[model samples]
Target chain A: MCRPLCWTYASGVLAVLAARTDDTNPLSGLVVADRPEPDVPEGWRLVRVKAAALNHHDLWSLRGVGLRSDELPRILGMDAAGVDEDGNPVVVHAVIADPDAGRGDEVNDPRRSLLSERYDGTFAEHLVVPARNLLPKPDALDDVEAACLPTAWLTAYRMLLRSGARPGDTILVQGAGGGVSTAAIVLAGAMGFRVWVATRDAERGRRAANLGADAVFDRGERLPERVDAVLDSVGAATWGHSLRAVRPGGTVVVCGATSGDPSPVELNRIFYQQIRIVGVTMGSRDELAGLLAFCAARNIRPVIDRVLPLHQAIEGFAALEAGDVFGKIVFTIP
Target chain B: MCRPLCWTYASGVLAVLAARTDDTNPLSGLVVADRPEPDVPEGWRLVRVKAAALNHHDLWSLRGVGLRSDELPRILGMDAAGVDEDGNPVVVHAVIADPDAGRGDEVNDPRRSLLSERYDGTFAEHLVVPARNLLPKPDALDDVEAACLPTAWLTAYRMLLRSGARPGDTILVQGAGGGVSTAAIVLAGAMGFRVWVATRDAERGRRAANLGADAVFDRGERLPERVDAVLDSVGAATWGHSLRAVRPGGTVVVCGATSGDPSPVELNRIFYQQIRIVGVTMGSRDELAGLLAFCAARNIRPVIDRVLPLHQAIEGFAALEAGDVFGKIVFTIP
Candidate 1:
């Protein structure tokens, strides 16, 4: 039988079946039971989740983020690809911001919150999201491929396209083997950009080349020529290198700092060379739609390192924590 | 006769002088002597300076910036408005970069260097600059008014227009009393943007309002609403407030750091809100030309706090160092 509530904890606790009333480790507690699967709430639709992918954010949530111990039994997971009750396969964009909340651009609204923060998110057997967040999954892609896109893939798409880069531009992707970096390399290569990869590990560099990077280099290795833009997520360690690798008037887009934050900003280089540093989060629903269409039209498939049954999610999380995966680790549900 | 070389040094040492033969202190070493006036080089024009502006940068040059004790006998000033050899009034653009030195956009060239750093600057009674750097001064404006541009005015123009701001946008000008902030307030006001000024002194706040700012606030005070962009030259101390004052997806354009360079960056706000931080330098020749045309067409007179004779330049520098002037302090040649 499909489990109702999914509970997660930091100390090797994995997603498990639970009763609606039972709550231990209240912060990580969640009751996703079969208490009348969510019905369409006006503009929202009930998606019977066929698959949902895991992100680092999901793990961060389990460790208690933006959720108090009193707000127990909160649904977790941000990326979902599933079938609506009408039996149509669709992908759910994870960012759950209201369109009417801001003056001009909805993305500019400060009150906006993503799924799993203020709202119950995916990972449930049945998930209901705003109709606008639902993009039809391509007939060519299976549920697993569609599930891996809403967070990591959407972030990579916006970072490359919306950050003022054009085709035939040269882009440096810092940290080669992660989900966003991998996606950026493939997307930039497809867009006809000369994509260079920087990585500390030689194995990751080789993998980046295999994933269609034009060239690969060690983390701080000098390039033959400066690039037009740099996609930097490895924060403190690669910040200086990102500044040095771009040409004058170039841009560096930063999404997350997995290594650390608080890097020494080289103000002299920034002003003297007229450099731009742009910060991006996951994209909007409109951008997510565009990304899905672009991927479907271009036959671009997300790189999936492994997929495991929902019951075996602990193994997947362990693999992720061990840093043994090159791409996304997904969880499949019935 | 104007001194070909002038010299000054710590502890009664003779320093700078300008002469046909290289002197140890070109600005301070040699006495005034009769020498042949400079002729315009090819693609250049000789400007017989009627008025020259003393910038803080000029003071820094006297203290040695990109200059050695060996190359002491050098010309100083970067801002000047004078008459050409043909007796046409002109304003000299100080940045002397080779237009054809780099690939694609000449402005993006790394090899470009400013006047005082490389070639002779505007301090002497007469100086030669590239012909393109000369903009015709309107007969309506006097030499002192025209001389206040080139560096500070051009920089402010580019920071407002070219730094990702549209008309009708709202911006926060951090540090309301400085050269760039004062210029930004006037320019942004004329261009139809709502401008807010932030400063430590309440008196400076009133002064900023008189300069055409819509509102003024105490430093680091929470704004009623987040602005579309922020103009930040005061780093470290005001960096946090600058970042906080802009809405999500807004921009922060930085040119200098009177406070300090490195600051504690709030990386969470940056990434989650998708803010853009752009570093700007002095404007290009084309930009300077646009600024000249804009001011001339609009009849905008630069704010001049005081004027001093060229011989009393030390007093001008002293006033600038005291930071009490409301606007630019210009030095006029007799």
Candidate 2:
């Protein structure tokens, strides 16, 4: 449908783009195409991306949740690990915001935007970002594993830190096998928390146990004992259960609402039981740096579901949209 | 309906009691009658009540919200100041709970009950409580003012302490003239916070100003700027406003839902903005002590609307039910 000029590597670089959009079928708009290499603005650096990971954000972008119709052909990715022009390996911190605007915590910035929302993203063989966006990737992790740390893993790490649960405390993670939830299970175990997973899928529960959850429960099942905090990404489907699963004066830390928001939230139960509901998004740049150091120090490796060549990014998106991934899906750039 | 035998001072003490329940007309069950003076159990001390304060809890008790039918004729009061057996002037810590059960914070105990809920309360000539429940009343405060601190003032103090807002930061107190809200206005100012009040009544707004509120807004009005935290006890009527009034990463501290619980809680807004919703009941014994010391040191006085003889307790309940109060209503014992 295009002149060959659009695909010529001499003038463009290979990348995945959300060329169009479909609310019901997000994959329809996904395109494996070519895009001009990003320019390095002043105070920015160009990175040759060695690997990238797919996330729910990509599918949501295709469905126009955060992307606009006019922004079609935008590169589609948020997590990447690569070599900078100076040859240092780095992982990009996806959030783009002025640290001062958020009073030193960039996540609180009102004008904050993710990589793919307002600018070219990391899906391409070459990408440009403000120089401050890069954190040194630990030598212990390969490109694929480092690529998994920026978005989901960083979010999961921050959730646990915000949960206010000390070591030896118990936490209930609602929803299993999702990127953030799975990361929380593994990271919480490493952080010395007693991790409990609740999922409707028995297979996913088993997989979560394999990743080090101390206990697993059927979704909405009453816990054997109340936890000190709960991490809920399942939202409407698991909100009530999360509320009831925590002890009085306990906390429920929420990061996402994948199942939709619950109606008629039980404010009575929230106040009567003296519960706390804390929300988190992706962590700050300093937190991401801390995550990388912690993982390297602890010898933690990200769970990779599968890796595909960059040209096969469409298959990766399909698997993610179909809810078929148990861990991160990586695209290795050739 | 009682014989003269029930009225003898030697046989019984004069008290306000909930003899029955009527949900729609709560005042119907309120009875000014005679009840036997409480017997001191082991480890319990009896106090001759000099003053007691009225709260919405008294009305709710009359409606049988906490008092069961089998517990009818229950004495109804939670806040009291009086002379203990040792002739020491003391204030009762209304929360009757074992510190061991809640890891030293009695408010977190599942079996915790307020004075009027599980035991005969202070709207009588004498009351009994665990010996540990007494704290010395500051000589600077009279019996009436000390009586106002335990139930509502302590709750407001704890709510502000838990709000996570630092001194010089702004806080919005929703529903301005209720006991907790009024106490928050006065205490927040003394605690060095910029207190903004939201109220439906303009008169209450002006009165809040006289009590040290830095600013006032009509209920649900858009704030000039988002606050660092919001104190919300209005619940359904003000929940949405409370959510919107705070900045991202800010807190909304809740203690009661006097206007009924909000429906369709905005979980999406909560998570997306990284807001924190904290629920609080009454404070702990230690926190109550801290509140007393702070109020004394800061020269903070509870705003008293009126002081009436204990025999006029029914009139006080009627005023509370009719929403005709600006501050605390204290009943002095004969």
Candidate 3:
């Protein structure tokens, strides 16, 4: 049996991880206890996890949105920075797409699954993953900081670069305080794109400006002029405004719609103005590598709102659910 | 007084070019008569029109959708193939953007306007336009055929190449027999891409197969597999199918929506799968030149469904509105 760790559910409620005979609602039945250690498969390595970061996806996992309870007692973490048995420090790329599954980009494979959804994740003291998932962590980043790079930072990096913005071009980042939005503001600024952020929260707008935004606007407010591109992760609520903020022949890259989906699409505005709306998911392993290199080369650091001991992970999940954190909440294994 | 050949719109009847005016739609009140020839501005040339093609935009012009009644006696055609005063045969590229517009590509310019919308079009025996709009026509293509290339064919070329299908990739052209769809199927085929077409009419599907479609399917029928890209011009009715038919990471390029706009978007499918949807309006002068060279080099011809004398234009518009033609309809002049 593996050494147990914490898991979260619904909102703030949390429980200790444990083996359950009834696979349904694994988190509900979780109770901390000792279990046999995981055996690493060939071409995989056993990572002695030093840190794991909590993402909104983890809470969703606990609510069993993406995972069946049968996959339960499932380890629930996507971002991990750890040391190998050989003692090399590394960061794990969360998306696990089968290389041979689909045509073209591996990230597009329908069969792909992130860690903790189909496989046990990095929340525990030790976890097993395909060796290919590992990237050497930059020495400049501590375990907690490096743990934030794989999911949110990597997604933000790809959305900015691959969505067709050039250096010196102005970009409007929609819904500013989320993980990807914050990452986009910092990265676009570093890459020489003028960054303007929109947020409903006045304080978050101020925080974005502090984080190097060229300008900050109240959510849904008209800008002085149209921009070259819009980085949109806020869905439904900001969809119309995002479309309005871009100039003709400009692009809007959407990675998520946290508010809701199925917004009214202004098709006339889309076609008549020749605006492009591109959809992006979390990025690929290659993109994660590039992101790591980019951040490391430029000494870019992820914002970490709070760090909790692994045993105190319940508090970390609570912080995320309360939406009180400015950045990521990480759990360090003692 | 200047002589102007004009169409008059009367109650519940088709607009007809008349020698004398009667009370009706004020914009169409002018009679067909001799007009003083327009003076060519510097950097512009006068073309003695040998042929002009009528499009829906022309009919819309007659309906006063884009022109004012005060702008009546307006010559109305966006496409022309003619000889300049120097007697060199040329095709006029219809999009007239500001020459000094700031740009990476001229298509990105905000001040761009189509001929006949903001400027007098090419319907008359003589028309004046900027010299840059003239693309020398190959001797092999007659004036009527050359007239068809500027709007529909150029839009198709830009949508296929610039909208991101690499040669040898597979594309699903939604709606088999419109001007743009036919152009796309033929151009994509000639450019070495595997082309599949979707149409509601079985006969049109068969015709698409004849026009070099690798395969043709019923509208919204499941393709054997997803294509690398989809060319969508039929907007509302087929937008969802277009989104579904493209493989993850593939693109859907739209030029028009003959059916209507504001189709329900499958935003969940789009973002979850990482799809791209781009909107293209028309082509640039340089793209028109490339398209001309491509056709000239490959012996590619625009498919003409019917050719009529300029006076028989009402019949052409009737056939177009009736949706009976499989390809472009051109009007010839003596």
Candidate 4:
């Protein structure tokens, strides 16, 4: 699964760049072209990308959410697996933050950013990241499988850990087709939790069952029993149901709001029921390491929607933008 | 100030009862009249009330929110200090639910009801409660002060304990004059937290500062700095401000929503900033015990607005309903 550190092709390499941003049509900015090899700063290492995965974050970047215009032509991708400069197989921890600034919790760093948001990213033959951001890739997971672990999968993994649900407790994952929801279903099942999914699409609901959801309900359907926690990425659309689905003293772990923000924040139900709503973003570097180890130890493999070569990265981004990806979309670099 | 358990008053006793309910004029339901002395059920003990405290919950009960029309003519107090049949000075823990039902946390019990909801309450000459619901009242706190703790003060104590803010960290308490808010300010300061208050009235804001608030700001004013957490009971009125006042990864602990339920639950800000909203209600019996010990050890006294004889309980309820009270309004039983 490891690729050589690309010492021969140092000048130019195939990469996907957010050449320009369009708020409505994020994929219009996706360009699959050649990029100059990145410069490794002090304490940074270059890794030759073996496989990179697409994320909603990539679409958001092209829509100018976190990526600024001045930082345009930025390479796109937050997750990857490859070989580091020292020829060690590694998986990239996408968050670039000063741990000291956040008092050792990188996610709390105000200036924390993902790979492509601040630097050239993993959707290339080669990319550079802080040396500390590399975790040893377990041999059990192939490059494409390991590549899917950093962004959506890592977010889901951390959400579950922080969800306050015990292994035997039940958790409701809202939405089924998104990358984070799919990953949460599989990981939560493997982690010994009873996974229940709520999705509008019946087909996706069935797939969720195959992916390890113990029960599947129509989106907004009243659950037969309240869950111990709810993992929610579809915000406003499912927020009410999420709140209603959790038992008293249960938690709602949120990573993203893809459907839009819910309003009339029901403070009454929250205070009366003693519900805990915990917000989570991408996980920490240590958490990512733990995720990789957990996946390897459990013999868990990420559900890849499709795999494409780096030159065909635009199609991957297009599929993700169209909400057509059921799981992860990976781009392998030859 | 322990009242003797009057064995002579076996037939009738003076009590403030909600004879009826009024949504607009809750005071219309108030009746200070004679009621038969409560019969102690199995495992229940009689506590001759010395002093009882008023809470907003009393107002809600009068308005028939939790008190049903069928359950009307119920007693109206939740906080009390008195002498048990064994002549020990004790503070009542108002929550009455089967410990087994809530798994030892009465607040989480689905059928949990306060003292006045299902049984006789403290605003009377004598009341009956489960024997386990009494704690030895600290001699350092007089009956009126101890009476205040079992309701608003205990609620505030629990909220701060569960707030996730460290001793040196700052907490923003929304509203300054209410029982919970006033208690939060005083207790938070005594617990080593820097207490910041938000209030609509300048006089009340000044009063809050006098009661241990480190700073006070106009309601909805932008804070100069984000706090580690926000204690919000103001609900819809301060919900948005509460969200914005907290630092990233900070918390907002909500106990009630007096102003109204905030609309637009702001799922975006909640998940994006990684804000945590923890809902808390009244403390458990253990927590009430802890509050007593903390107060006794720290020489903290609950703020009392005014004390009236139980015969004149209507005035106290009126003051609370009018929001003319700054802290607790206690009614002493003769």
Best by TM-score: 2
Q: Report the Cα interface RMSD of each model, rounded to 1 decimal.
A: 1.3, 1.0, 1.7, 1.2
Candidate 1 lDDT over residue span A1-334, tens digit each: 2223443444322332222222223222334333334456898888877788877665556556555555545566788899887898899988777676655556666787677666667766778788888889988678998898888888888899755667888999998777788888888888888899999989988988999999999999999998989998778888889999998888999988767675556666787788888988888788888888888889999888899876666566556555677878888886
Kindly report the interface RMSD of candidate 3, rounded to 1 decimal: 1.7
Q: In model 1, where do residues sit more than 4 Å from their true spots?
A: A1-36, A63-71, A100-104, B1-40, B59-73, B100-105
DockQ ranking, high to low: 2, 4, 1, 3
List-wise, what DockQ does each model earn? 0.62, 0.71, 0.52, 0.68
DockQ, candidate 4, comes to 0.68
- Model 2 spans > 4 angstroms off: A1-10, A20-22, B1-10
TM-score of chain B of 3: 0.88
Tens-place lDDT digits, model 3, residues A146-256: 999888788889888776878999999997667788889999999999999999899989889989999999999999999989998878888889989999889999887
Deviation from native of the Cα of residue B268 in model 1, angstroms: 2.3
Candidate 2's residue-wise lDDT over B142-246, tens digit each?
999999999899999999999999999999999777889999999999989999999999999999999989999999999889999999988899999999999
TM-score of 2: 0.95
For candidate 1, the chain B TM-score comes to: 0.86
Q: Over the full model, what C-alpha lDDT does candidate 1 score relative to the true structure?
A: 0.75
Model 4 residue B330 CA deviation (Å) reads 1.1
* Model 4, span A1-334: residue lDDT tens: 1111222234688888888888987777777777776788999999999999988888888889888999988888999999998899999999998887665678878788889988888888888999999999999999999999999999999999999888899999999998899999999999999999999999999999998899999999988888899999998899889989988888999988887778868877888788999999888899998999899999999998999988777777767766787999999987
Model 3 - which docking category?
medium
Enumerate residue pairs that collide in model 2: A264-B264
**For model 2, what is the C-alpha lDDT against the true structure?**
0.89
RMSD in angstroms between candidate 2 and the native structure over all alpha carbons? 2.9
Cα error, residue B47 of model 4, in Å, equals: 1.5
Q: Which 10-residue window of candidate 3 chain A scores lowest in summed lDDT? A: A10-19
